[model samples]
Target: MDYKDYYKVMGVERSATQDEIKRAYRKLARKYHPDVNKEAGSEAKFKELGEAYEVLKDPEKRAAYDQLGSNWRAGQDFQPPPDWGAGFEQRGGMPGNEADFSDFFEALFARSAGGARRAGAGQGGPGAQGMHLRGQDHHAQILIDLEDAYRGATRTLNLRMPEVDAQGHVVTRERTLRVQIPKGVRAGQHIRLAGQGAPGLGEGGAGDLYLEIGFNPHGLYRVEGRDVFIDLPLAPWEAALGAEVNVPTPDGKVALKIPPATGSGRRLRLKGRGIPGATPGDLYVVAQVALPPADTEAARSAYRRLQEDFSSFNPRAALYQGAQS
Candidate 1:
């Protein structure tokens, strides 16, 4: 499929703001309305413009489209990237409106790549007299490990589907299939499994199965884009005396060096060790040095000794700006 330059179609820049894109769309649409222009192909161009704006004016869709990157030139005979839409939120499947676009458009953005195969599906089928309809395509959700997003993995999934019989009675069936979970797939995105949906109507092709992906929340890390954040727990001694602390990451455990006299909330960076493939997103370790709980006599005695050693330290005064307000 030829890549469409949505921005050029709307006369906007790659960084064009939502308002700017919208204004451009409106201006061009008004100028070229076929009802008024009466020019050849004006209607087609106008329809194309509207579709482009519909996707780009909204932040969510625009973001998803942009993440595909500007390396693609409009009108280029292009193939999708090996791992497209990685870290992107996907809109749910909406079947193509045959009345709306060409096959080329359908190929470029087939919201419903797989279709339901139904037997005797029409409102009144000639064979409804004795034929039972095929069941609808089944949808499933798969929650995968975060590492699976960084490095793709395959899973064996068991799917259960319910079908209605001729008399409209519901019966359930289970099917097991092995699915490949592509790396970098984010929440809300789905993988289409061709011919994996329901049985087709009168020998029609089976519908596609869409698999939605979700990341397993890491106990030690929080992910944003490629960057991952972690709260690094530190002993008071480790914070004050400068020590190498063992830190946990999605990849595994590693010794992270902490400079001496580091304060609470201090950030330590581990470059090229975050989510994979994305510049190895940097790991931001926010230090949270902890002291012993003051519930025991031994702990109280230790606190007293530390207070005596640094009695002049006034954390409260510094925190509240000495009651500046």
Candidate 2:
């Protein structure tokens, strides 16, 4: 997807305040509005303007967009960073028609749009007359360690929440919360904390705070759902014969058996050893042969003797046979 520099689209500077952004968007929008211009591509320009304004006008969305950094240029190929929205707390729902927006807008705010629809459907309109209006639900992404998924953990998190100050400038407020992470909570799963969102109006109850789970980059493991994978480095002798090697997992280290003549890229599975769950995922140990260097005279001599012992074995015989065919 191509990156849309919202500031560039609205002809505003990166350091422009909320008021400056509003004025810039208004001027450009008037020039591009289809009803006024009636020129070719005017509608497209107007839609683009709306999309840009949609993000800039809101303190929450603007704060999130700014986190994407300033190195990106307009129209450049773009993909959001893995932890792009992590630690940001924003109220649910987006105003305006979502269909009129570009994929770039949807990519970032689709979750908020969906939350808006769900909230409206379940709780009725917050503006209904004589109704006790519930507060808006909030959403955020929080990162946890892989070990936390194996065993439940408690974490203290600091979240940045954007709001408009009395001067109409966007400002960020820091909020801290102590949260409990349940075992087997996979990435993309949400943990909901009741009464932690925006305050209610009148006699209604406060809305919920939903935290989406994400795993921190693990040093030794990769996770897929509940499954875990780790590279098991084996010496040349261990690969040629069999050996019992210590493998580190989220739970702890365990001795894994290597079969005779194991090759690099072979995967050995340990059942029910991944994230804790009723139907737990398996841990996969991928074999990687670590060859010893022949820098020393003794090592060179050993390699020469081994090469002579395997002189009849042609490892590339299949490649040569394929070429002939």
Candidate 3:
């Protein structure tokens, strides 16, 4: 797909504000309107202008589009990355008719306009006789800990949704839901709660709400997919002579056996310690040997003794020879 530069289409900077985008769209729309311009290709240009404004005028759509990154150039061949819309809360309202939008716009915001025609199909909108429409599905992203993936959890979220008021105009309403986080749900996965989205129009059931999974940055752990990693600090003696230590896992602390002559950056794995599933991921501990400060006389004496003990050894001999080569 060719990447559309909405900002360039509207002759505005990528950092332009909502008001700036609106003004640009209005000016371009008037200049390119088919009724006024009558120039060849004026209709297509007008449609393109509307599409750019459709995304840039709204904060949510604009933010979601911007997350595609700024590296792309206008008309560049592009495909959206996986999890493109993973961390956004999108409601089921279209600013204008969806039929006027391009294929790229539809693909990007498909979830929002999933049931647009049926949302208010029969009762009285444009070109309506009487038809039933399924309610539109809504999507949101929720952040959880690595432990929550190991052990199932329930999370509460507050959302503002659109509702049709007595005057038949849409109004925003705050709604809260306690959602379940399934065990072994990895990052970028989704939890679907049935019948939790916008209510159906006539004789149709409510839409489902999809919660996309995201992980909060952990102070002690780093997660990549289902696997987990943590830096394990070890005393110099513990690394050299080997020791049994209690290591923290997603579940709890477990006894880990350190092999003798272990070096810094050595990785040790605990099988089946990561996210639980049919096939579980392992937990890896990266070794980081820490030395005691040689400030006191006793510590300095011990260090001197160690230096004397290993006087025949040259740690940088290999590096020095390599550099000479």
Candidate 4:
């Protein structure tokens, strides 16, 4: 599956607002509409535009697409992440008068398209034109701590969902469930809970719920895949010379060896210290040197002594040399 960069197709930024996207779509739609322009490939361009707008126009679909990560490049080999749309309700309908779409779009969104068409035709409801349909699967995100991934945890989730009632009118209902988060679950991983979503119409089985895992931003740590990173602040002297420090990890504090002449931005790796799994990721401790405030006479004297000791070293010499060159 080739990745589709809808933002690129629509000539808009990823941060483009809804109005901006609409404006861009309208402009391109007018320019590429086959009826208005008989240029070569105009029909194809117009259909592609419609496909892009079909996804970007809807907020829910746009959000689900965005969660796939912005790191993917246009035309890159793309496989939709597993259960990417698990808890999300699929809304039907395409933006334009097109019936056929690209393989990539169909693979990712065709189920929703079918559901929408059936809904528009009044076929998804119970006894709707004498047709029975299974409930739509629901998708949602759950936030957890990095430590929670290291150790399995049980989480309570509260969700508000809409369903048809006895009178055939849709009603919003709150549902809560206690879910167990398995250990080593990475960000964006899905937890499928069977029969926990919207109720089925008539005798149809209830839909399944999918919970996508997300981690709240940790103040001291940043996670990438399974790896974790922390900025360890050290005194200037401690960084300049060797120092044995105990750094915090998800497991606990561990002794970290700081080599002599270590500078700010130097990263020390602790193997197998990240989220536990078959092959655990390493923990990276980034060094950040801290300087004491020159408020007291003792601090001022210490700084003066250090300045005198390294007076021959010119930190700005490289900048001056570059300027001269």
Candidate 5:
């Protein structure tokens, strides 16, 4: 969707308060209203002003639009991220003349909905008076760790939801809900808690809760797909001659075999040890070779003799062809 700079349209600065926006709109709207001004393109300017005011006047819409930032030029070719504007309801998209806005308004603010015309009925189609369907949709976001996806867990989450009272007033009410954390659920994945949403209108069923997964950064491993990867630091001797090293996993430490001649960045796979699932994922150990400190003359002399003994084994043989005739 194209980004709208309502601030620019209303002729107000980015830092303008709500009162300032209202004042600017009042001044410009009077000059642009076709009925009052009767100038060329007055209608067009009035429509644009109305659109800007419609967005800025509403606190929810204004806050959401402000989060998009001021970097976008007024008319630049724009696109929202895949997840952009997903959670926010497009209030201006309703059907009646109560919101007689254009498609441009709908594109940014709402979605076009059909009235569900069923053929061969006594009535032509379902109208507003027909059957008032659609109980209120419930919205919620739950946070889960990256490891929880691999290993399922149960958690107690504190949920606070804002709801409308019988008189249509906005009120935030709090409640404690214990939710299940299913394995293999990735970040951005939604877990629906059935019938946990707002109560439906009349006799309709309740809405649902959508839980979005999140991960707290792990101390040792970085998760990717079904696999867990960690950098295992090993001594130079362990890398050259192979050794059994203790490595950390989410569960606990385990002895890992480092094969001889294993170079840095060499990966060792522990099959089916990752996040518990019907088909388990593997754990990968990437070798990070560490050298011993050389702070003594004896150590320097021992290294010199070793270098002299195997001096011909220049590892960088492939780098240059002597660069000479």
Candidate 6:
């Protein structure tokens, strides 16, 4: 998909404040409005302006858009980076019709709207005058440590909340929250905090805040579902002859026994050692055989002795047979 530079579309600078952006959008919008200018492509130009304004006018969307960086140019081939909108808190619904916006706008903000709808947010639209209506539920993504999923943790998260200031210009206010993360919370799971979202009208109660969980990049392990996987490096001798080695896990280090004749890429399962729960997931230690370098005379001599001992063993025999077949 092509990148649409909203600032360029609205004829504003990247450094333009909310007020400046508003004025620029208004001026361009008036010039491009279909009724005012009957010229060809005027309607398309007007729609483009509206799409740009839709994003630039909202502080939350604008802040998220800016995070995409200033390097992207208009009409350049672009794809959003993974987890681009991970930390920002967004309101429930979008104002305009989805069909009116371009693919670029939809790609960025449409999923948030869909998530809010799926969460049952903004139900029963603002009722009659003076009627008490529930506040809209908010959504955001947060990063946590892999260990935090194994053992519950308390995390402090700073969220950016967008609101119009006294001057009618959008500004972001930082909100810090202390949240409790439950154990066995997998990636993409949400933690709901009641009454933490937008305030209600009149006497209605506040809505909830849904925090989607994600794990920070781990150096030693990779997780899928509740199961965890880790590479266990072993020497050739240790693979050939059974040996016990120390293995690291989320809980702590434990001794793992290697079976004799264990081959590389063989998985050794540790029952119920993964993310803790009623029926816990298993941890798999994948074996990786490490060959010692023959840089020294002693190491070279050892390799020569092993080669002589296993003179009949041809590791490439299968390859030669397959070629002949």
Please give, for residues 109-210, the per-residue lDDT of candidate 4 as tens digits: 654232222333322534564454565666665678889999999987765444445643334455678999999999868788887655566576666667
lDDT of 6 by residue, 158-210 (tens): 88877667765556788999999999999878899999887776677777889
Full candidate order by lDDT, most accurate first: 2, 6, 3, 4, 1, 5
Error (Å) of candidate 5 at residue 162 is: 7.5
Error of 5 at 172 (Å): 7.4
Q: Mind giving the per-residue lDDT tens digits that candidate 5 earns over 10-118?
A: 9988766667778899999999888898888898888888888887766545654665777888766676533433333221223456766655567655633222122
Count clashes in each candidate, considering only residues at least 3 apart in sequence or on different chains.
3, 0, 0, 5, 2, 0
TM-score rank order: 2, 6, 3, 4, 5, 1
Error at 111, model 4, angstroms: 16
CA-lDDT, candidates in order: 0.67, 0.86, 0.78, 0.76, 0.67, 0.85
TM-score of every candidate relative to the true structure = 0.53, 0.84, 0.67, 0.63, 0.57, 0.74
Which one is best on lDDT?
2
Query: Which pairs clash (backbone N, Cα, C closer than 3 Å) in model 3?
Result: none
Residue 234, candidate 1: Cα error in Å is 0.3
Which ranges of candidate 6 are over 4 A from the true structure?
1-12, 17-58, 71-84, 93-129, 164-170, 311-325
Q: Provide the global lDDT of candidate 5 against the true structure.
A: 0.67
Q: What are the root-mean-square deviations of the candidates from the true structure over C-alphas?
A: 15.1, 3.6, 7.9, 9.2, 9.4, 5.1
Better of 1 and 2 by lDDT: 2
Please, what are the lDDT tens digits per residue for candidate 3 over residues 13-107? Answer: 87676667778889999999999999999999999998898887766677678879888898888776645754455654665553677767777
The residue pairs found clashing in candidate 2 are none
Whose TM-score is greatest here? Answer: 2
For residues 290-325, write the lDDT of model 1, one tens digit per residue.
877999998999999999999998878866985786
